[model samples]
Target chain A: MKQKIIIAFSVVLLLFAIFLIARDLFHSSHSMTDASCCGDDFTSAKQVDSTLIGYKRIRIIETGLKNLTGIAVNEKGDIFACGNMQVSIFDAAGTKTKTFNVDSVPGCIALSGNDLYLGSGSHVIHYDTIGRKLAVWKPYNNEGYIASLAVNGKYIYAADALNKRVLKYSPDGLLLQDIGKKDSITGAPGFVLPSLYFDIAFGSFNDLWVANTGRLQIENYTSNGHFQSSWGSSSFDNSGFGGCCNPAHFAILPDGGFVTYEKGIDKIKVFDPTGQFLSIVAAAGSFKGNSDFQLGNNHLVKDIAIGINGSIYVLDAYNQINVFRKKNL
Target chain B: MRSKTQIYILVLIISLLTLNLPAIQRFPRPEFEGKYQIPATQVTNIQPAILQYLDIAVLIACMSLISWFIVKRRWRKGVFWMSLFSLLYFGFYRKGCICPVGSLQNVTMALFNHAYKIPLTAVAFFTIPLGFTLFFGRTFCAGVCPLGAIQDFFAIRPVSLKPWIRYLLGLIPIVYLGLALLYAATGTDFIVCRYDPFVEIFRHNGSYFMFFIGGALLLTGIFIARPYCRFLCPYGVLLNLVSRFSKNHVSIAPGACISCKLCENACPYDAIDKPTGLSVKNDNRELIKKLIIYCLVTPLLVIICGWTISKYSGEFAQVNFKVRLANELMTIERKGEPVTPATEITTFRSSGKPVENLYREAASIVDRFYAGSWIMGGFIGLILGITLARLTIYKYRKEYLVNKGNCLSCARCLEYCPVK
Candidate 1:
């Protein structure tokens, strides 16, 4: 009988505790709905900016491209975009010209003369301008991803973001030297990639430029794999690179400047040869529905390219290439 | 009749052979002519909301049935079958997500963080077992909990541990509960779910080390009888307290006590308490004096324990990612090291959040740990004092009694009762 009394008292106490918890849970569920009253409807780019800062929206080309990973333009102004296990060629006017099916999805594409280089899976494949396969480069020890590709007169550079190293290869696909390994003797600080946004571009003098995204710096390396200098700043403001890694995609302008595209705050900015922030071609607000996208692949720059006439083409998260030209001020 | 040694060898041989059967059956793969494409597999078929409701309903039903079998029907076989059903439905089918043990963290998080909303199912999962235990004594542990049920299946050829060792190891659950609650309340990590030994086995895909740990625990369970539940499960610490105040618990005998001592060695978990031969007239005065002294000294014990644990509050706070990242960045800065920042550090810097703000937040978390550890230590001290007091005092009994706090309510002792 005494045991029963103790148990009854404890049961009442537990019941009261349960009642309090239930009430709080009920209130939380209702309050959560009220807090997110504005559903996830994204603000469109048209609504955010009537004029996309010093650039006119010349074209909104619609391509049936999914996972549009890489975009490049050749001397002939032909635009090449690779994704969805295929490489597509578009004329200067955004008309699809030809498509070549590939075995694996290419992470990046680079154009030299008439030869198109593709960083697909762990191997680089070369093809003629007319889509005929040329040579399959010997497979390199790619850790997991081949994130970016760059081609110069004598060498091809593949940025292996997974291994956090850049591989310089001969035109015939023989691995030459591994760049970006931390070496005190060479005074190279190596690459701080963080996420898969390692981009490499060839300068006019055949110098190599790699984006050490984690450090928010673009590193300049000599053709012989020597670190020259690096410049960028980690800041939330307009002048600096922001997020874990940014300038996810960038193309070399004709005059040796860089047209860089950033994720998280989806924007396009131009930098001069000396790595100074030149001007904002497009602000983050110019892209619709990207404000809430977090810093990752889902919100990363899919691809970027520059036409011969200095038009900036940006393949955004939505797979639409927005061509921006200089506005007549 | 077979000897105990012979039975042990036989069971070991059978278990070993069962474990080795997979290696023995090596089949060749069939060749296909056309190109083969693997079908895309959906991770989960059921909607999470609907599945949560179903899980709660099943938990309530299983708890009631387990209590009925152990207390009213006194059927060990019935309880065993129910446990098997629980292992199938809650363990394999549900993939071990909406579990009461892990839900303890969710409840703690909700209580501490007003902005954090816990699913209604998680609250029910946490509270229902406690409510049931207050009335019926750990019916959830008996069969409803899939973790317990899976271990119970392997609890064959069990060995009894020494009372001193059992008491010493019993302190681990209280400490684990404290750390789990501390981490959860501060939004650091869910240590319970992360370290759950049996969940890997249920899911069939998890960290490789966890799989080995699960296998090792199952091997230990073959001899130790629900080792995780006795020594590690933080939720078990909560259940043990509620069960002590249970209104009705399983008794060894259904009718009159014959004192035949048949159930003395029956319990594999060593939950049976022997009768105390002390009479009220002899040891009453000395026992009362000692109990009063222990009660008076318990507060001092609490303060001492709290101080000792608080000294390591900074170390404990490192379990949070932000605190850890800040510490790493500070270390790198102090050393002037040229090492590349990790992904987490890069993300933090890229997000443009103020580094000083991160340091301040880490300091505040350390403060929370200091206070939480003190309360946890004080709690353990109180339990220790109560345990000592209970042991020194005497209770008059003629028959074997189940230790309410320790009993799993598995109903195994019911079969040994002669008066039934």
Candidate 2:
């Protein structure tokens, strides 16, 4: 009888072992079969409160570019979509204005008055509105990858994701200063870019705002490169930034409002001057798909360009610029 | 054995599993001011290379000591204590990595993949145990192997399984070995390491699925004794073959058997071969007929198994990450659904690699799997055929003896001999 009980218990344990193995195999196989869809985490995070979304996608301008790396809008509302060894311009009404070819694929683009500054590879190239190459400046840093460019009257700030520094260059492309470095005197906590997602933009006060993405904070620096203050938080809530590196790309509004686009969870949000969470311009589901940043096809929203009309032009991974406008507008 | 000590050990192990402290950060730490830089996350560096070599050295030393205890000293108590030391040192201290069991996959990968440079430590770990088993029988399993030692410690009331059940269940290791080799050779995965029942217990962390499986196997080990070594270990299959031709194997008696039945119930692993009296006369005509029939049937079984497994090679190829991704992409296209932009899909797009190139690469891997599955299936079929054929012939013995292929050389039967 004792042996019988032992045998019965052993049989039960054996069945349990078989069940465990079978369950594991089933889960793995199920995951493989379900690989065609987004993961549960992604799905759960994708569904945001629709009422919180303050903006709507107004238009999708298909630039016909094979790969859209960066987009910039000028004061005159002429949109420049640069990628695939060419820069295509679209008017404020989403009409194709002009297109020009470059020697190499433009890493990023910024418009200074009528002249366009293209960050191609590690160097900056000056171009006129009609696509004439004006001057090619020396490479700011040969090893640097210019992921973003923000230009002002006196200087051009190139966000170098490789060196994890913002290179401030003169109008003629002379190296001026390296901003966002850790400094005891200036109280600058150096930029911690986990991936190639450092972005820089000029705020309403002309103060430089840099996305310290790894820290999930937006830092403010003086135009001359003095550290001022920073804001933002790390959270899965639509009001906060999350993931490895977020606020992947951001553009400053005329009223000093911040338009921030995050990768991984792929949500675009807006914040006031004091870094208060205002509203979500686009949720994760608003884009083509949820993009978890990786080396090769990283940028979900490659570049966020704000139009003069407060329209947010998002250069999505699908090589199209999605224009989002406030629902009140 | 003190029940209190056993309970304490069990509690300690459970605490290690339950205390899932945010020990290892999966993401990079936020950089703060001052000299606080987040350390670089190392992908696969569990231990340093020097320590890896030390693990090999320790393994050899332990196996040598256990081999001496089993073969020369013939001391069961010494073997038991040494095995406990191995369980603590190799199992818990080293976290059961660089084990000979998992090293077989490294050797297989190195053989099949030209780019894979088999680490010197892996080569040593794989060969040293086989070399020891060749000379001194399965003394490695007797105490040096932490997987076996852990199970051995739990085997207090091991009941003898029927011969037919043992023979039927024994085929699992062969099938597992074949599948492990196939997966490794194809560079799909290291399944032997992935499904190692005791490695998680040794690490005190890992997939909960594996932890539960390990717990279930341990519970069953109370009655069955070394269930994994006998029926599931891919590495044990190799040791069993090598130990069969061992020069110095374990002895049931110090000298000749006194015909006493004391040693009959001694082996918990049921490796003892009882004497077959002369009353069972050998029938040569019947044996020859069965042998001829088995010879004819074995090759047919191999072909059938090879063809059947080859037919399902596509399903098996899904285990490969690349093949699975390609299949997913194709499925999305076929279903007319928007690509969900998974990490793999996004990375593939950003690579600027053409979709055709990915599909072509995945197809090539599937072709390799097709060839590997045939061989894997034929290997399993051949083992099954041999196991079935082995039942037809029996060697007549006048005295009780140890089955060298089956015995773990644990030295338990040595104490049962009154002649000692």
Candidate 3:
């Protein structure tokens, strides 16, 4: 009798426990968190406060974007992000206006005036603000990606990182000067491992900030091809850029300050004119699948655009643009 | 007989594993319309799952071979060698998925989670071992599965419970089935997948605690006799019940048996049952009563259990948090006002911890505790149900006992008669 009673109690308990587990699973599988309730959280990226407050999170909205490589912003607070095969235009309101699709992916985008200069494999394209291909310029050998491009008064500087040289061209696509050569490290002041020199921007003193990716530092050069000082390394957390390669893509701020973004760590940090570490404007937040229809590819945060109006726009993988305007800009 | 059978079964399974099946690298000719084009199988790829199943196969083959050696050659005794081989085999090479426990886990998961990625191990273990169960009896379960193998080692020094207790313990598989389904649907850890001791033996190069647990089970298997097969495995229950109705049935078959009762004691799996010749008279009415009770109880269990599990289904995490989130991150961070890339603004962001495994992590402690107590509980219910059925059939047994009148004139009685 005692044995039977024990069995009876156990059977009831087992049945009950089984009940709870079954109930829990059924509830979890079908229900979704309300976006409005998950507001400011990643599930709800549309929760906008009227007040421009602290920046929080980034929500990825789409997937299947092929190689969203590099990003850049334009003057109208629009973003011109590119891949080797295409260029994406995202409007101020975070929607794609148009896409410039090419046979080969466009790697970098630098906006000037009302035009967007896009670097495709071995060629550079000049596109109108509305994303029409105006003209295409190909290098002589055209081997690999045209990694970086910068424009100053009809002078277009193209870094043939694969070719180990910067090809200077006129606005009409005329090749003017091909500086540096294949495998030549140009023993300039702070040159290191050279492959594809990634970024070249006309900085404070007509000093071009050459983000030498392989060397893991930013090299500065005079507009006339003279070498200047260099700052940064593959270390970034504690004043020095972290990692083994491509440390600095410093976007110079209007207040004589600078903001730098790291690719591997996925963070944007701020620095002063003297390279002193400032506040981290955005921390490494959670990434969801395919949020940006504008950010073209995964590896292209180095291509960003800051308008004079203090609005910052980022082109993500697959031509999606993440536009950030200052609270009081 | 044992050594010969073990050797035969081992050779068969090993040959089958290496046989001309659909080689993963060699893409099969398309059979279906509109199926996703199979990617050209990469030559360098050794799927993590294939290696895991092979580990189970190797463990089974090796255990049988060692068993053959121990019983015939007397090189060793007990399940020490089996436990050692499983641990070392799983440790040095295919860390843990090498056990059939994982496949059982998948079977449980499949019944609930439709989108579940069925590990090839599950299919292989199921089709092969289960085929053997239907044909040659539970030889696949007898010693091959590392869990069974380990338990076979431990059948020593058990606190022998009553047969009624043992019979009751056997009903645990049903409860496991229900719980496993709930978890799989809830997107919880495939509990059988996650914490199985034998699979754990194969995973992570053999943790200290796993060796202890595995060694304990094997030593216990020496005395307790197929404990996991008896009470724990839901798949075993499925295959066991199916094996009963299998075309190639296992029985004494009246003539083949010499009425020696040798195979009954020799059978480590306890699958051998006595013929209905000798003990037909004592209890007939009890069987009818138990049948009626079970008929009442089973429908109630099905309805009540199903209803109760469906009630609390809301709390389970919807996302399989372990899914590689590279794509997930990109979509969430897109749209509207982009946050500035100032690294200093450290806000509490959701870590890429997959939510699918979340509920399992929460329920693990409660689940494990409940699993133990429930097994005991289910066993008791089964005993009472069986006892009640025996009460209903008592009157019929008295008439059937006199001169074997209810027995068919078949020679099935000759096997059990010592007088023969």
Candidate 4:
């Protein structure tokens, strides 16, 4: 009798197990067939041609380097691109010149004369133009993520995205001051860096231009880190920056205009010095399926560098450098 | 034995019929113009931390009850009820997160990565079970572990496997433990949690392939008897080692055995050891020579195993997503093809991370795997040598005894013992 009861109990348990297995198999097969039905929907939703008027693609230079992070153009038109663990320098004619390895993955680069500064991890490494290591700067706080770099004649500024502040260092690699603190008295609203896209550039008048990404605006500060003025608006249209954080990266054009790259919509636009909306340089259609701008966080091709002759160099997410010139030029 | 065989056949027929019912039933179909949609408002309210504390308390209570039922009352029914409660609370209600089995990886990751903060509950889940097993001989496995509970319920009409086959198959859990620890320590992957078979059933959503695997395991458990616990559970390997040194363990008989041999075949797990007579008639000198030879060859076995596994370090490193992505990018670059970046590549490029740096980091991880795999292989070889040596040595016993390492403290043998 006990053995019979055990048999009945085992049969019930076995039946339940089999039921769950069959149901799961049915659901999986149904989902697999359903997924195929939506295959056409995926291809048909390709981004349309939304190219901003005025700029023309002059040349597309294949850098051959994957995961390019930062790009900077010097006065000599020498382009330096920072990627994974090494930085590659190219001449104006798009010829590779020098390549040297850094200790850590280089994040951003800034070149002043023959001195090149590369943000590798927490430290800003200074190297000579010929790829010789010159000086290693002091580690920014242990937790800081140095995402962008900008340099002038006297000081080098590192946009520490993780700390949400900018560390200003003297030419000799001495810590000078921390900027962009949330101080109501100084009226510094602070830099809002939700992700690691904080970028900085030195303007024509030596003003520090910082991409306050989270607020969807660019703020200018004096050489000594005083809050100056800011301009930008959040909009999904072509007139303003949009998405979770607009203008993920920016560079100062020679004419004091701003070349800004918005991540989610993957558009590169030009703004006047007063932050007035200018013409579009590159549109979302140009990037096509290359950008990842889903939801709030956009991780697309970043960093814009303006060449000496006014040619705009944009690094796509895959590290391919796209050079855009004025249409009539 | 005749009735047991008859019951097994009867149960098998019923189960097969139950499985065939879906194919036999034909219902009138209802047509729809478009896909059927069920509007599900998924309001995911994060459960409070205090509730997690309550779960810890319940786990403690279950373990205590299981220990009492096994050691004092010698009641298998009590253990089964406690196991059912564990399956409901930990498996169904808690969705099997923070389980001691998965907590092994968290504890391992915390030991290696300083930045990783193991939650207090995870530490509690990990240590408490091992602590209980040290004194009570796997009361946690007998009742409190949801993974074990779910499997134990399906284990009926289990046939005893050959001793040699059991010994060989038993080596798998050690290998699994080695691989899990290697992956966790090197920050490669949490293979245990990622490949947890039954977690999908508990959570009600997972990979389709994993669901099939889970169902297949439960089906196998019907005849194999706790297949996951005996062969695949890395934490069970730890418990097996800890239970060996346990001060108290479940005994087959409540008092005297009387050498009746009735309870000899009672344990489906083959944990009951038949009594060996007072003396052995084997040649002692030959046995001593074989033991010495085995001891000398053990290190050589370790070296060969370590070297062989280390050769496949590159393949093992593929378990890491970064290493795999870096390898893919490198392969594309080498092929001189136009790169179409995937989502991971796009994310990597947008983060301004360096490709050379990624490659270098991946190479370093591959090196770590080379060393880790060597350690894993050597550890397995050592375990094999020790198991072999123990099996060779014979021990004298007055009566039948429960194998401390294999007995789950379910107390099934207790009912068959006439003295009890």
TM-score of 3: 0.47
Q: Which CAPRI category fits model 4? A: incorrect
Instruction: Report the error of model 4 at residue A240, Å.
Output: 23
lDDT of each: 0.74, 0.80, 0.49, 0.75
TM-score of every candidate:
0.57, 0.77, 0.47, 0.58
Worst 10 residues of 2 chain A by lDDT: A289-298
The digit string of per-residue lDDT tens for model 2 on A118-195 reads 887777888987889989887656887888889877898888888888898888778888887788787788988778
Best model number under lDDT: 2
Candidates ranked by lDDT: 2, 4, 1, 3
Query: Lowest-lDDT window of 10 residues in candidate 2 chain B?
Result: B31-40
lDDT of 3 by residue, A143-219 (tens): 85677788766688887767766778888888888754323365574333333536677665555666665555566
The backbone clash count of each candidate, in order, is 1, 2, 128, 6
Query: Which portions of model 1 miss their true places by more than 4 Å?
Result: A1-304, A307-329, B1-46, B279-281
For residues B305-353, what per-residue lDDT tens digits would candidate 2 score against the true structure?
8988888788778788888888878987887644354666676676567
Better of 2 and 4 by TM-score: 2
Chain A TM-score relative to the true structure, per candidate:
0.79, 0.83, 0.66, 0.81
iRMS, model 3 (angstroms): 18.2
What is the CA-based DockQ of model 2? 0.17
Q: In terms of TM-score, how similar is model 2 to the real structure? A: 0.77
- Using lDDT as the yardstick, the better of models 1 and 2 is 2
Encode model 1's per-residue lDDT on B1-420: one tens digit a residue: 223533553364345325533553111111111222222212343456877788888888888888898889999878877987887788777777778999999999999999999989889999999999999998899988989988887776676767886887688788889888988999987878877877766665565655656666666666667878887789999999899999987788878778889999889889998776756637788988988998888888888888888877777776666777777678767976332234355446534568999899888888888898888888878878887878767778767999999999988888889885
Predicted complex 2: CAPRI docking category: incorrect
